[model samples]
Structure formats: C-alpha cells, structure tokens
Target chain A: MFTISLVGPPNSGKTTLFNKLSGQKIKTVNYPGATVDYFSADFDKKYEINAHLIDTPGIISLIPTSIDEIITIEGIYSHPEFGTPDLIITTIDASQLSRHLILVNDLIEANFNVVVIITMNDILARKNFSIDENKLSEELNLPVFKIDLTKDNGIDELIHFIKTEVENNFEKRVINKISEDTFTLVNKYNRISEIEKKVLFPTKTNSKNITKDFNNLHKPDEISLKIDSVLLNGTWGLLIFFLAMSVTFASVFWLASPIMDLIDSAFALSSESILGIWGNNWFTQLLANGLIAGFGSVAVFIPQILILFLILGILEDTGYLARGAMLVDKPLSKIGLNGRSFAPMVSGFACAVPAIMAARTIPNKRERLLTIFILPLLSCSARIPVYLLLIGFLVPTTGSLTAGIILASIYLLSIISSLVAAGIINKLKNKVITEQDHSSFILELPTYKIPRLNNVFFNAYLSTKSYITGAGPIIMIFSVILWALTFFPAGIDNSIYNENDSFEQELIENSYASNIGKFLEPAVSPLGVDWRVGVAIITSFAAREVFVSSMALMFQVNISDEDSIQKSLLKNMQKAKKSDGTKVFTTSSIIGLIVFFIIAMQCVSTLAITKKETGSWRIPILQFFIYTFSAYFLAVISVNLINFFGIA
Target chain B: MKVRNASQLLNGEQSEILGIDYNHPSARRIIEVGFTPGEEIKVIGKSLFDDPIAFSIRGTVIAIRKSEASSIIIR
Candidate 1:
C-alpha cells in the first residue's frame, strides 16, 4: 500500500478532504508523545492500488512553536521504519491560498515528492479568483488538484492521481534550499520573483465580486480585537460563561428527568414480575434486590450524560469553545496554567477519560500532567447521582431549589480547590520541565453553521452504545458479588429471617453474620461508614456509576423504581445513628462525603487512558494515590470541622 | 506613508504591502499562518470573538492574532 500524507493548517478542511477521498470517518487521535492530531485511513481506489493516507495535524511552519506543530514537523521528518510516505498530498483552502503556500514551500524545500490539493474551489469561484492550474504547475514544477471537499468534487481525480503515481514510482525534485542560500539567490537571480509574478495574477475584471465574496471569510485581527475587548475588559464574557454553564446544568437536570423516570418504572416492573415468578427463593431474592437494582441505578443517569454531551457538542461545533478558552485564559494564567487547560477541565465535567485525553492539547508535560492530576476533582456526571440522593435526603423539600444551588456551588468550589492544588504542586515540586511558549491563540472560528443533525445524533448514539455495552457487564458482575457478600452464610433455616420484609432487607439487617460484611466492618468504621458503604465505595472504584449497583446489593433493596430507591435511601440514612447516638449522616458527614467524592480518583477508565497517553503506568498510579489520599484526608478534616462547629 | 489597520482592508482592496512586526503576538501569528511582510492579505470575515481573525494570505485562509493585525501597516 502506498502512503500519502495530507498536511495543512487547522480548519483548512484537511479532515473534510480526507473524508471525501478515503470515505472513512475516524475520530482524530492525538499522536502519542505529541500534542499533534492525525488520522490514518486505508483508501481502496478503483483504478489505483490500496493507499494509506495519513491526515496530519495543522501546522503553519516547518519550524513549529505549538506542540501540535512540533508533532507535525517530527511526523514529516521521522521516516517510519516500516514505511515512509511515497507521496505527500498537501491540502490548502483555495480562497486562502496565500497563507497555505508557506507549507507548500516548506514541503517543496524538504524535498518531498508532493502534490497540492487546493480545496474550497467554489469559494474561489464566488470570489472571482481564478487559479490557472497549468500556470501554477509550471511555476511550482508540481501537480496541483483543486476541489471543494464539502461538495465531493475532484475526489475521483485525486484518487486516480494517487493510484498512478504510486504504481509508476513517480518522483519529482523539490526546491530544498529556500533558506540555506536565499540571500545570494535573491541577489543573483531575483528570478524566483519574476517567475512568481508571471504565475500568480489577480483578476481585476471582477474586483467587485472578489470584494463581495471575500466578506464571507473571517479577518483574524478584527476578531481578536473584539475578543480582547470582551475578554480583557468587558464583564459580558464572564457572564456568558456562567450563563451557559447554568443552562447546561439546568438542561441536564430537566432533560434527564423524563428518561430517568421511564427507566425507574421499567426496572420496578421487572422486579415485581421476577418476585411473582420466583416466589421468594434466595436466588430470586438476589435477582430482584442485587442485580436488577444495581444496574437500574447506573442506567438511570444515562439521560444526564446524553444531555451534557449534546450541549457540549453544539458549543464545540459552533466554535464557541475557542472563545470560552480565550475568556478563561487570563484567570488560568494567574494560577500558573494557560488557556489550553480549559477544554480538558471542562470535559472533565462529563467524564475524566476524555478530559485526560484532551489534556494532550496542553503541550507542556507538567501542565498536561497537572491538568490530568486535578481533573478528577471536577464533579463529573458520575457524582450527580450521589449528590442528588444525599441532598434529597438531608435538605427540606421546601428549600430543595436552594439545596440544588448549594450542590452547584460545591462543584465550583471543587474546581477552585483543584486549581489551588495544582498551583501548590507546581511550586512544591523541584523538577524543572520546560514549558512550551504559549502559542498565541489563533484558533479558526469556523463560520457559525447549524450543527449537522446526522453528525450529532450519530456521535451520541455511538458514545451511549459503547458506554452501555463496554461498562454494563462490569456493573452487573459487581452487583452479583455485592449480592453474594450480603446474601451468603445461609441461616440455620432459610425461613429463620423475618418473613414480612424482602430477602434483601433480611440479608442486610443480618449481614453481620454474613461472611463478607463482617470482613469489611473494621476498615470502614473510621470514615463513619458501615461495611456496606465501604463495599459500595470499593466497587465504585471500577467505575463511579457502579456505586449505585453496589448500594442496591448491599442494602438488599429491590427498589428499582427511582423514586422508591431515593425515598428508601433517604429513610434509611435518616433513621441510622452512629455509635455516639447522633444521626450517621449528620450535616458534617454529608459535606465530608461530598468533599471526599470530589477529590477521590474513582474511575478506572480514566487511569487506563492516562497510562495509554503517558506511555507509562507510573503517572496513573501516582495520580490514583495522590487523589485517593487527598480525598481521605479532606474527608476526615471536613467531618471534624463540621463536628467542631456543632453543625451536625 | 499611508497607514491602514489590517481590519480596514476590504476584500479585493489592493494596497502596497509594507512591513510586519514579527515580534508582536498577532504579527508573529500572522506570519506563522504564512502571511509575510509584503504578502497581499485579503480581508476574510469576522467570528464571535472578533479577534484571532482569519484572512487569505499566501493562498491559505489563515487565522492570526488580532494584536498582530495592528502591526501590519499597509498602504
């Protein structure tokens, strides 16, 4: 298979072009050991042999400043041991060809056998800018293909070109000494300029058309000044960030309610049907109380996850994310971080896995690692269920809205704490890792286009499907284990336990006699949690959502109906007392628990990703320990502080 | 000397390209995006941020820092 590398600046439609030519839609993955993004596709052309196309990250220069740029440069230079690219297909937006020619020139100088793919030809046509293809080819001494990627024009021609070149082993010499002796060359020949002038001509006949059409493209300076005006001085930017965040949370809660209720009712119906068929056997009891309840708990939160992703996807696609990054950059810089860290941190609110993955964009190793380290501190969607359950139990119904406000406040507090912790860590550490000069933020604010519905729904479906299939089994198994832990040590008579209550409750009340609960009782007592909560916490380490299942199994409750489970948990927590005769979930313990969850490293998926991204287990392991310890210490302090103040 | 801010250059506006301050953040960004001093830059459009603007320079629609745009003294 022949390799063709597609290179261009960000938002130059390189990925769009790759999609058109290869007919493959793959998520761009960050190159390991570099912040640059790339995607590889195997193209099977009709006339041409199968070719491998590498879509490289955007770069403006051969000498790169940003991590992504550096990666692109390295990818270009580092000839793969297995295979080096046989041909390079450089894509440039035709309407903006002037800026793109730099990369073309650099590639030419690098001596790569190159072909230029100029995209957005329609835009050029509208602007009355005509590219004399033959003239350009003669001037540059290379093949040039122009297309509109969105319209899928010129793709077949491109494929045909690739096939022919690869088969014939076609080679073309590129100018490699543009900078080496350009001073002498400029003085000696001025010949290069003469050639350029002859080849490049502006059409004056349709100058009005050109001006009218050019209004469609964004001018970088005006946009920057506007952003500076708002971000640097105006309060509107901050207000927008806060307002958007508020709406996000509100939508998450509102959109999720109906789906959550449906899931609850479905699970409740299943439990009731199972109980009727099984007639109260231990196995039936386990199925009803442990397995069904456990899965149902986590499954209910799926709606919230879906809603959050939808909002974020829209914001990202609309190019508002870049503005948000710009808005937050100064505040972040004050704390020794930069604007690049904002995306990953925001992503952490959904799930830490992608947030950690997104950290690759940060460029600096220390900043990336620090961002990864503190990401778990953000109150991810996983913690929402725990918060809702606890807050509903403790706060009065009349002021539930105020309780929700408090929950939101705590999430903000967590972010602030994480930033503070990152700063402290940066200062305390003696290690001197070089930080990349901040790449002047020059993100292309892609024209505001209504997000494609097909793209949004397709992404949402794939994400939800993966979560259900990939993470579902682990949750089920954990539920079963939790059931066995509380269910085993068969009583002298199976009928010896109270007959009125369900088997689940019988097992928990008598759990001391059960082998598993007895084993965990000693270790969890210090945190003011019974062995039951400890077991849930441990199972949750696999995935925070599994806590719901663990809780259901531990409690031996078949309350699969969401409302029932909420009510039961609230009732149980309210009734239970510590050894000292105070309520177990006193105000302090609740705060402490929330704080613990805020700082705790609970998701295994995040750790796995960190290991993959860092190419080492050391960082993930270190992260786990640091976060776990932080959670424990903070929980202890919070509990004591609440007690000290007599708030409990 | 005619000094016009880059933002003022309408699409299809033809002017003598002068010099660029490569050290200026926006100027460096403009250059990085393939906009060199003396290169003809065509005004593109505006985005929400109103800075980090995009333009057609050297045959590519490159975005540069707005701060850099101020340094491009075009006649």
Candidate 2:
C-alpha cells in the first residue's frame, strides 16, 4: 500500500495540514511533535487513496538536530528498519517561504516524489503579501497546492492533487537541478532566490522597519506584543505562570471529581451485580473481589490523567508554553538546563512517567538527563491523594489556611528543590562527563493561536489510551499478586471478609503482606511508621494512591473503599499505635513521614518508564536507591531535630 | 569592508552573512536553516540575560546563543 508522510519545519502547521488531508485528529499544537510519536492510520477513508497516512515530527532540514527530528528524517529516507514513504507532502509555512523553501528544493533534487504544500496562505494574504502558485509550480516543475488547513479552505484541491499526483512521480518528470556535492548552502540560497523572483510578488508593507535600527521592535501582530509585554515580563510572567498552574491543578479536582465518582460507582455496581449473579462461590469471590477491586483502583486515575494532558495541549496550542519557557530561561540556565526544561517540568505535575518522556524536547543530553532526574520530585497528580491523606492527619482542621499553606509549600518545595538538584548535578556533571553541552536556550516563540477542540480532545484521548494499554497488563498483574498475597491463608479461623469487622481485620494482619510488613517494620519504624504502614508503603510501590486504600484496609474501616472517607482515615491514623502502645503518628513523626514522601522514589511505573526512556536500568536503579535513601536520611535527621527542639 | 560575527551585532542590527566557520559541527545546521553567506538577517531581540540573541533570518525569527552566533560572519 502507498504510504505518504507529512513533513515540514516546526510551527509550520504541519500536523494541521495532515489532519486536513487525512481526517485524522493528530495534535496541531504550534510546538513540534505534539503527536509525541509518529501516528499512522488507514487513509482509505479519504479520497479513494488506498494508503496509510503517517504524520512525521517537524524538521528543519534533511539533517536532524534533536532526537525526535532524527526519528522523522530516518522515517523519510526509509532505513531498512523504518519504511520509505512513497510520497512526501512538504508543508511549508507560506509566510516564512524563503526559509522553508530550502527543504522543498532539496527534496525535489534528491529524486523523491514531491508535492509542495504552501500553508498559512491566509496569514500571508492578511499581511498583504501574495504568491502565484501556478507560476511557482511551473518554475519548480512539481505540483504546488496552497492551503489554509485551519479554515478548511482549498482542502478538496489538496485531496484531488494527492489522488491524481500519486500516478505522477515528479522525480521522473523534473530534472535534478544540482549535483549533490554542489548543493552547498550558497547554491541552495541562490536556487531559493531564483524561485522567489519568479513566484513571489514583492509586498508594500515590509516596513516593520525592525532591522536597520538597533533596539527596534517588530511583531507580526500588535496584540501579541502587548500580551507578551505583560505576560512575558519577569515579575508579571512569574505571577501569571503560578496563576495558570493553580488553575490547572484546580481543574483536575473540580472537573474530574464527578466523572471519577461515576466511574467508581460504575465499577462497584458492576462487581456487586456480578457477585450476586455468580453466587457465593470461590470463583465469584475471586472474580469480583480480586480482579474488580484491584483493577478499579488503578482505572480511576484515567480521568485525572486525561485532564492533565488536555490542559497541557491547550497551553501548547496557544503558544503560552514558549512564553513560560522564556520567563524561566535565566534561572534554568544557571541549573545547566534552559527554557526547554519548562515544558517537561510543568508536565511532571500531571505524571512523572510522561513528564520524563517529555524531557526529549530538551536537546542537550546532559540537561535532558538532569531534567529526567529532577522530574519525579515534582508533585504529580498521583501524589495529591497521598499528600491529602497524610495532610488530613498531619494538619487537623479542614478550613485552616495552614492546611493550604502546607499543601502549597509541598508543591513549591518540589519545584524549588528540583531546580537546586539540577544545578548541583550540573556542576558535578561538568567535572566528570566528557561531553560538552551544545544545546542552548534557542527557542522560537511561536505566534499565539486558539487551540482547536477536536485536536485537543484527540490528544487527550490518545495519551490516556496509551497509558491504559501500555500499563494495563502490568497493573493487572500487580492487582492479582497483591490480592493473592492478602487473600490466601484465609484468617486464624478461615473466615472470609464478609463485613467490616475485626475478624476480617485479623485475617489481613496475618496475611503474607502483613508478614512482609512485619519484616519491613524494623526498617520503617525509625520514621515512626507501624507494620500496617509498612505494608501500605510496600503496596504503595504499585501506585501511590494505593497507600491510602491499603491503610484503609488495615484498620478495617467501614468506609475504607471510599476515597473521600478522610475523616475516618484521620481518626484511624491518630489512634494507630506501635507494639509499645504509644501513638504512631506524632506531629514530629508525621512531619518525618511527609518529608520522606516528598523525596522518596515510590512509583514503579515511573521507574519502568525511566528505564525505558534512558535505555538502561543503570539510571533507574541509581535513581531508586539514591532518592529513597536520601528521603530516609532526610526524614531521620528532621525528625530527630524536631524531637530535640521539643517542637511537636 | 569591516566584517563582524553575528554575535557582535547589537539587537535589531542588520547585516548580510559573509560566511560561517567550516570547523563548527553545527555550521551545517545554521546554514541549512537559511543562515548562509549573503542572506540578509536582523538581530531581532535578546532573551533575558542576553545569552540567546534572537535573529530574523530569511523573514523567520529564530533564537540562537552567542556561542552559535559567533560562528557566522556578517557585514
């Protein structure tokens, strides 16, 4: 089957054009690779073309700069591993023709079947510039189609062109203009200029007059400059960034709660009905209790994850992330990273797994690694439930501003500490590593545009789906193993968990995990955690929120399954005692627990993703131990100091 | 004619690039992105702290660090 690749330089609306052509809702964010990975789908749905449509990451040249660009270019050339695209749809931003045309010219010369697509023609026309497409196509000797993929204009022409032009491989028709060796930078420019002379009519309003005078400003639009003047101002930019972040996190709670509750009740209702239908056999119990409960806990996270990606998609689409990057560049540079680190750092708030994956945008290898190292320190959505559950016990009153301060402090602590960690690592890295940092904070602040809803929703769904599918099996395995560990050996009396009673609780205490927890108690007791807490902490490695649910189970609370049963959680935790009968959760001890959680590398999936991304177990293993031990030592020292001060 | 590296040009300064140093590994990239000799470019803006100076090359604005700008000679 014929495979066509959509290729262009960054911010040229490349993906937008692909969406128009193929009717596939790939992300059309102004930044590069909002698709994250290459997306291919059956294009038989469009215009009788029996082919697959592949959307490639934006590239500046046939020569690649970053890792993602390398992927796209390698796909284009059809390395034995990745297939060669049968046809190339070169989407050039019409307003930036002179710079974009060089690649188009190269592809034509390289003996590839080429169709030149001039995108952003409306923006060009709005700026009062014109290009004659017939003249351009005649001169270039390839089919040229002008389109504004956003407005859905000239799409039929683009589609018709694709249908007819597949039969005509332009490489057979158009003579190669220059020998490969002679295609130097000078010759490339000359060729572009000659083409420009034939096709482009000189415009009258080139008079932004930003060039001749030093310190003059030129913006394509006045509104953007005005917005940037405030939004990108050092003081204002920082304030607005925090405000934006507050809204982002706030939306995760405010928006996702209803949907999450619905899903939770749905799972509960389905399991209950199934249990009734299957009757009181071991199979029903296994199917209902083990599989349903286990899968339900992990599946509840899907909504929050989607909302996080959706907010980020909106920010990327609007070009606000670039401004945020510009705002943070100076401070980040001191930490051996630059503005590009902002995107990943912000994403870390949602999930460290994807945030670490997002670190690919940072071009420098060392900085990218540093970004990955510090990313887990960010207070991801996974940590929110853990923090809240602990905080409920740690800080008593619900209405107290102190609770908010503690929450805010945790978030702020994560961000600031990660930055400092990056800086310190950067210093050490320079002395040890042989590589020099080549990538600088060279970001193009893309023009602001309204995010398309279809694209945003598409991206959100795709990421959420990938997360579920990729992690689903492992999570299922986790749930099954944990269930077996807890369920088997029934109790001291072989009674199953019929209701919320101390008898069932005794059974849990004598379970395999509780036995393992007893063994782990010595290690965790130093931080004021009991055996049950130890069990929860161990189970928490499966996922963070499980810590709360595990704690709920150990005490056998009537409302242990309810995520919002915080009052019961607090009461139970307060009454929890060590074997010595002294209260386990002291103010100082809880503080220590909080501190330990702040830095501990707890999530298994994050470690798995880190391993996959870094291409080895070396970094992930080092990260796991170093971070966990560091958190342990920090908790120990802080707890000891507090006890000495008698401040609890 | 007095020639200066793009790094030396002040913000909003205009010059035609004379040549790029052949020794630099990324000179190929700088050139490939329409930064070759005799193409007119303007120093558009400097990011905060001025390490990365933005340049308008071939009518598209792109930012490059002073280290990279040092490789391109312009007049």
Candidate 3:
C-alpha cells in the first residue's frame, strides 16, 4: 500500500487534520527504537484512498533535539521498518509561516515529494491578513491544500486533489544529502522571507492596515497578548494556576467517586450472582474472585481517568498548559525538572503509565528519567482503596472532618515525597551523566482558542481505552495467580477449625500464601502488622489495588456490597490480635502501613512501563529495590517512633 | 546599538537579535525558532521569578528560561 506522512511543528493543527482525513480513532504504538507514541491509520474507504497515513511527532527542524524529533526525522529519511514515505505533507501554520517554512524548506531540499498544507488561515484572517495561496504554490513548486478542517471547508477540493493528482503521478524521489549547518538554515529563512514578501497581503485593502506594505509580515497576535496579560500576570497567574489544578483534582476525586461506586457494585453483584448460582465450588470461586474481581479492579478506574484527561484536554486545547508550565517552571527547575514535567506529574496522579508516557515531552533525557523515577510515589488512584482501608481502622468516623484531613495529609505526604525523591535523584543522575548534559527548557505559548468539545472527549476516551488495554490483562492474570496462591493445599482436616473459624478462613490459613506470609512475618514484625498484613503486602506487588482484595480474603470478609465489605473488614481488623495477644492494628501500625504504601514500588505494570520508556531494565530494577527498601526502613522507623511517642 | 542578552530586556521592551552565543548549548535551538540575527523580538510576559521570560517572535509567542534566553544576544 502507498504511504503518506503528516509532518508539522507543534500547535499547527496537524493532528486534527490527520483525524479529519482518516475519520477514525487511531491506535498509538511506540515508534521503533523509541517510546514516543506514533499515530498511524489507514485512510477511510469512504474517501476511496487506501493509503497508510502516519501522524508524526511535531518538530521544529530536521536537527534533532529530543527523542521525538529523532524518530520523526529518521522516519522521514529512512525508517528501518516502514522504509521511506512516498509522500510527505508538511503542514505549516500560515500566521507563523517564516518559522514553519524552515521545516518545509528542509524537506524540499532533501529531495522528498513535499506538499504544503497551510493551517491557521482563520487566525490570519482575524488579524486582517491572508496568504496568496496561488503565489505560494508557484514559489514553492508543490501542491498546496489550504483547507480549514475546523469549519469543514475546502476538504472536498483537497480530497479531489489527492484522488486525481496523487494516485500515481508523483515521482519517486530519492533522499538527498541533509545538512543542518548554520548557513543552510539562514539561507532557507532568507528564501522564505523573499517568498513571504511576494505572497502576503492585507485582507482588506481599504481599511487601516496593520502591515507596512508586504515585506514585513510580523504582527504579534493582539488577542493572545490580551489573554496572556490577564492569565500570565505574575501575581494573578500563579493563583489561577493553583485554583485550576485544585478544581481539576477535586472533580476527578469527587465526580468520579459515585460513578466508580456504581461500577464497583455492578461488578460485585455479578460475582455474587455467579457464586450463588454455582454453589461455592472451586470453578465458581475462580470465576467470581479471580476473574470478576480482577476485571473490576481495572474497570473501576475508568471514571477518574476519563475526568482527569477531559479537564487536561480542555486545558491543553485552550493553550493554557504551556502557560501553566511556565508558571511552575522556576520551582520545578530547582528540583532539576523543567516546566514540561508539570503536566506529566499531574497526569501521574491519575495513573503512572500514562504519566510515564507523557514524560516524552521533556527533551532532556535526565530530567525525563528523574520525572519517571518519582512518579510512583505520587499517590496514583490505585492506592486510594488501600489508604482508605488503613485509614478506616485509624479513624472511627469514616466521613468526619478528621478523616478528611487525614486523607488529604496522606496525599500531601505522597506529593512531598515525590518532590524530595526527584530532587535526590536529579543530583545523583547529574553526576553520572554530566558529560552529555542537554538541560534546556524552551516552550511555545500557542495562541488561545475555544476548546473543541469533540476533540476533548475523543482524547479522553482514547486515553481511558489505552489504560484498560494496557493494564487489564495483567490484572486479570495476576488475580487468578493470587487466587491460586491463596486457594490451594486444601488438605487441611475439618478438625483443625475451631467453632468460630470460617471455612474460607481455614482454607486461606492452610494455603501456600499463608505459609509464605508466616515466613515473612519476622521481617514485617517491626512495622507492628501481623502475618495476614504481610500476605496482603506481598500479593499487592502485582498492583496496588490488589491490597484491598487481599485484605478481604485475609480477614474472610465475604460481603458482596461495598459498604458492608468495608465495615466487616474494619470490624475484623479492630478485633484481630497479634501472636502476643495484643491489638494488631494500633495507630502506629496503621501509620506504618500508610507510609509503606506511599513509598513502595509495588506495581509491576509501572516497572514494565519504566523499562519500556527508559529503554533499559537497569533503572526499573534499581527503582524497585531502592523504593522497596526505603519504604520498609521508613515504615519500621515511623512505627517505632509513633510507639515511642505513646500515640496508641 | 549596544548588544545585550535577550534575557535582560524587560517586559514591553523590543530589540533586534544580534547573534547567538555559540558557547551556549541551546544556541542552535533558539536560532531555529526564528530568533536569528536581525530578527526583532519583544518581551511579552514574565513568570513569577522572571526566569522563563516569554517573547513574541515572528508573530508567535515563545517562552524560554532566562538561562537559555541569555544565549540570544540582542541590541
């Protein structure tokens, strides 16, 4: 099949154009030899064009500064897998033609079949300026499609152009010698300036024109300047940034909770119905606890992920994210990260996998690594259930102001820990990689526009889909394996059970997981938790949310509904005794558990993604051991200190 | 005209870029984004600490940290 690629600078509407052209939700995969996502899709048959289309990462020049740029430039000249593209459509922002043309000139000079598509025409028209497309096409000597995908205008002409002209008439051009010397860039800009002088004109000839003749076409966008005046004001801007972040986080936590509860109940109901019908057999147990519960853990996170991305999408579309980055850049740079790390860290609050992927935006490899390394300590939503469980044992009133304060403090602790960890890692990694230091922070503040709701929703849906597909199967498989670990070696005699002992409890006590937990009891004893909590901690290494299910199995809380399940678990936890006949869950022990969950690198999926993004197992392996050891050491110290203070 | 680092220009000040400091690592990147010699740039906004100053260049607003922006010599 024929292949075509869409290349452009960032904020050039290239991805939107690709979506409009392909008219489908596309799949994203890691580009060869890089973790940056590359979007590729086949053109819809309704267009009658059967070519493969690639939406490449945005870049300013052929000279690579970031991993994303390296992939885009390499993909254009020679992709090891897809080979070279038959045609490259370089999309340029009409208003920023001088800067955007640098890429087009490079592509044309390299002897590729380059076609120019001018975007942001409406923005130019608003500024009372317009490009003479015919003159531009003549000057560039390539096909120019001046379609406005936003209003669905000129698309038919573009489709017809591709259908009739691009079918087989394009010559097979060889890649020429590519040079990124200073003179070549200067010459390209000079040529672009000459062309701009000939083609640019005031939109209305009779009115007071902003342009001084045609030679100088540089007019700063007044609208953007006006908006930035208020939004980027030094004092007011920081306040607004924090307010916006708080609202987004609050909505994600509050708005998604009710829907999440509904999903939780739905999953629990199905699992219970299957068990009730199938009558307590091993098959029913596996289907309910192993399959349904595993699937439920993945499904329940959809609402929070969707809401977070939706708000982030709106902020991104309005061009506020860049400004937000600027607001936070100074403080972030103090910790060895730049403004770009802000967005990814905020995303980490929802899920670390997407957040790790988001770190591709950071151009500096060390900063990106530092950002990824601290992400797990940021209290991802998966830790919410575990925190709630332990907090319930600590706070008598579940919904009291004290409980809220405690919950918020735990989140605050996670945030503070991540920042501290980032600072430490940054200092350490800098020494090792000082020879190849490329720590630079350059950001573009795109003009603000009304957010397109369709695009925002589409992106939210896409991210939610990716999270499910990425983490779903692993959770399911691990839940089944965990089920087997806690279920088997069922040869215990009925006489071993006391009058109060439940059958499920006896089975779990006799299982291999219990043996392992008992084996690990000595190691965790200083944290003031028992062997049951030890088993739960070990089982949760697959994913943090598994701690809740493991806790339920360990306590033998067989309730189906959500509230009753928690209440029963709390009741069991409160009454449970240690091997010395003392209370197992004192205030000190709960504090220890909370601290451990906050710092431990428990999720296998996160480690897998870290390896994928960093392109090595060394960091992930180091991250796991370091975080785990520190978590345990800190937990032991915190438990002892709290005990010494006589809090419980 | 006297030359100074672009980072020294206050908000609302406009200047013509003289050349990039070749010793700086991000000199090429600043030049690639239309901050070449003779290009007119205006400081449009500044963040809290005035570290990452935003400038309007070629009709586009770009923000660069002061450490990197200092590489662009402007008059």
CAPRI verdict on model 2? Answer: acceptable
Where does model 1 sit among the CAPRI classes? incorrect
Tell me the tens digit of each residue's lDDT in model 3 across A281-307.
Answer: 577778898899999999989888889
DockQ of 1: 0.20
lDDT of 3 at A208: 62
Please report the TM-score between candidate 2 and the true structure. Answer: 0.88
lDDT of 2 by residue, B41-63 (tens): 77655555665666766655566
lDDT of 3 at B50: 90
Runs in model 1 deviating more than 4 A are A23-49, A52-56, A61-82, A125-128, A170-233, A260-303, A396-399, A429-448, A453-502, A505-529, A558-563, A579-581, B1-31, B39-75
Per-residue lDDT of A506 in model 1: 62
**Pairs with steric clashes in candidate 2:** none
Comparing 2 and 3 on lDDT, the stronger one: 3
Query: At residue A420, what lDDT does model 1 achieve?
Result: 83
Model 2 C-alpha lDDT per residue in residues A338-453, reported as the tens digit of each score: 77888888778777877787787777777787788888888777677788777887778874789888988888888777877777777886542334667665566677789888
Interface RMSD of the predictions, in order shown?
7.5, 4.0, 1.3
Report the lDDT of model 2 for residue A417.
72
**TM-scores for all predictions:** 0.77, 0.88, 0.95
